[model samples]
Target: MVTPEEIARVPKVLLHDHLDGGVRPETVADIAERTGHQLPVDDPAELGQWFADAATSGSLVRYLETFEHTVGVMQTHDDLVRVARECVEDLADDGVLYAEVRWAPEQHLREGLTLTDTVDAVREGFEQGVAEAARRGKVVHPRQILTAMRHQARSLEIAELAVSYRDRGVVGFDIAGAEAGYPPTRHLDAFEYLHRENAHFTIHAGEAFGLPSIWQAIQWCGADRLGHGVRIIDDVDTSDPDSPRLGRLAAYVRDKRIPLELCPSSNVQTGAAPSIAEHPIGTLAALGFRVTINTDNRLMSQTSMSREMSLLVDAFGYDLDDLRWFTVNAMKSSFLPFDERLALIQDAIKPGYAI
Candidate 1:
């Protein structure tokens, strides 16, 4: 019977946050003015609501257009530095101890910035924020994940960029954007390159799309993890609420222990799952899939790690053990080296849960 307050204070790790998607509205407005980019809304709260409305608008194209506004402001080095710094503060404030911010460098080159410059700017911000958090008495570590758009043709390039920045706070690589039509197979060359380089990446699948996307990402592209893998629940037959039947995909995900980055609020916002209560997380977790809760977009979904945990506590009556499972799931699924991850679980996570 852990209280929500207790859960909020517990340390957490995030695996599926988008750098552009999580930009605060006020930051967006300030950077837009500096970069001569006019945002659709000027008021921060209104703009926040506007982004959320558009993201949940049910049209993929329209939903994607929202990023145009976010990415528009994040063109310059200052913009990246500020956004990354604020992102660290926000995540630390929400009790996130470690997080990976993913964004495509290709999208931020509109104002004549190179891939290296962008990464450098973001790293600087992360470093600054880390120092600021220390002064604020919050201990947290933030890292970057370079994302390559699946529809576009620069995944291999992005993969190389990620490898180059590994020593500079870059943790891994990912392929995102328009999961419905753009399959990961289209980026097989990039995946193969990453695989050869011994790099880690997660593919956006099993959310807006279904089993085929997940299969192609893992069976075809060799993804180490699946982002927003909410739709993997589709493979389960729950005709009787008392008993559920796990289909081939669900069984494989379960038996193979494929980590599913489950963003509950974002899933409902995108119509991937009808509601949090209807979300298959509890069932899937009970059945033993390595499921990790995440904030797909803090601005778009108006969510945080605490909010996500609160919802799970409300919907499923999940106790401390359940929270431990979720946290351990994320720690295990992280792209960090095996030894480091084991230490976090054995030291930080286990000790934190002892309270």
Candidate 2:
């Protein structure tokens, strides 16, 4: 049995966390007050509950509405630095050794700051957080994934921003927002540019929408990984856990070894899955899909990597080996350089999981 404390002690890798979505409740309250924004609740605990409740409305749009308050407070450069720094501190406290945090820089320009300013601010915060964690005898490595809003026309610009910051802390680019009407094809120019630049990128597909969204993301936009690809299970036939059948799409994904960034709790909150026990991640993992568990929005989901892993242990009887397998999968699928990933796996991950 893997105790919660043991799980926390195990070095973890996160590939699909959102910067805006994981802001701490107290930080949100502080920023709200500082920025003169109104929150539904002033108390940190109540504000946290309000976000969790609002996200559970079972609509992707409704789930995203909760970000308005968080993002509203996150307009200033100081705010961005603070949030990014705390993001690292919080993840380090939870024993996350590496994480790729994604957020749309375009969204943070409302306070008269340029996209570069916001990105620089976040980078500064990440560095400060890393130094702070080191002082506390904890180490965390975090990289940024610049996201382009699917409903906006700034994907090409954002893609350029990501490339410009490639030598900095930016590791990848992403397209995020509602997945229904705004397909990945809409941002063909950006994807094509990223492909030409040999830049890594992931697509936000197969979460709110179905096969078409996923199909276009993979076959059309050429995503390195699928974000919240819970809907991929729709194409999988699991009449037998031992020998399940995969549809053409699912088979293609598995055969190609494309990573599926699966967020179980956030999936439930968005009605992607009914509950953790019924999530497709277990079946997909059992079937040898390249699945990586994640907490899409920690604040909204009220979760961490440890909580997510513990929930899986309770639901599916996964042992330490299973947890290690998931952690390695995430590390393998991360946008970090091959050498860094290998170093973390060999030095941190394997040693931590050793009996």
Candidate 3:
């Protein structure tokens, strides 16, 4: 049996965590108080529970409402830095060795900070957090993925920003928000720009929406990965458990080995999945799809990497090897260079999971 303690000790790689959605509730309350941003509850514990409860409303739109408070307090450079730093610290404590923390820079510009300033502040915070974690004997490598809101018109701008900072801390670009009306093809220019520049990007598709959204993301926009791609299960026929059939789109996704960033807890909270036990990850993984586990919103879902893995262990009876496979899948699908990715898998991930 794989214990939760064992899950916590193994190294993990995260590819779908949100910077704003993972803010510590205590930090949110403290910053909210100092910045004069009103929160529903002033106490940290109550605020945390409030976020968890509100996010469980079973609608993605309503689930996203919890972010207003977290993003509200993170207006200035200092607040951004603090939140980003604590994000790394929390991930490190949860045994995450490498992560790509994403946020929309445009949303943080309300406090007179430019997109460039937001990127720089987050980079500085990541550096500080890495150093602090190292001092405590925890080594973590954190990178940035600049996201543009799908409802907004600044994806091209955010893509350019991500490319400009490629040599720094930024690793990729993404577009996230309500995925219903705002299809991935809505930002074709940004995708084309990213492709031309040889940059990597992931699209948040097949979550709130269905196959049409995912098809546009891959077929039209050419995403390197699928965020919350749980809906790809729609294209798969599981009537015959002995031999399931895959549709064209599903087979193409699997044949090309496009990674699916699956967040079980967050998906259930947002009604993307009925429950962790019924998540598509088990079916997808069994069928040899490149599926990676993630925590979409740590605060809203009240989850960690260890918790996510533990849930899978209970639901699907996955063992250490299964956990290592998921970790390697995430590392391979990361935006890091091939050599660095291989090095982490060899030096850190493999050794950590070794019996």
Best by TM-score: 3
User: Which residue pairs does candidate 1 place in steric collision?
Assistant: none
Clashes within 3 Å, all models in order: 0, 0, 0
Task: Enumerate residue pairs that collide in model 2.
Answer: none
lDDT per residue for candidate 3 within 207-275, as digits (tens), equals 989899889999999999999999999999999989999999999999999999999999999998999
Q: Write candidate 2's Cα lDDT for 206-312 as tens digits.
A: 99999999999999999999998889999998777667889999999999999999999999999999899999988899889999989999999999999999999
| Cα RMSD, each candidate | 1.3, 0.8, 0.6
Can you write out model 1's per-residue Cα lDDT over 1-355, one digit (the tens) per residue? 6687888888898999998989999998877776678888888889999999988865556667888888888889988899999899999888887788898999989889999999999999999889898899998878899999988999889999998888778989999989877889999988898888888889899888888998898899888899988778888898887888999878988898889999998888878888899888888888788999999889888999999999999999998888888998899889888898898889788888887
- TM-scores, one per candidate: 0.97, 0.99, 0.99
| TM-score (C-alpha, index-matched) for candidate 2 | 0.99
Q: In what order do the candidates fall by TM-score, top score first?
A: 3, 2, 1
Native-vs-model 2 lDDT? 0.94
How far off is residue 81 in model 2, in Å?
Answer: 0.5
lDDT of each: 0.88, 0.94, 0.95
Q: For model 1, what is the C-alpha lDDT against the true structure?
A: 0.88
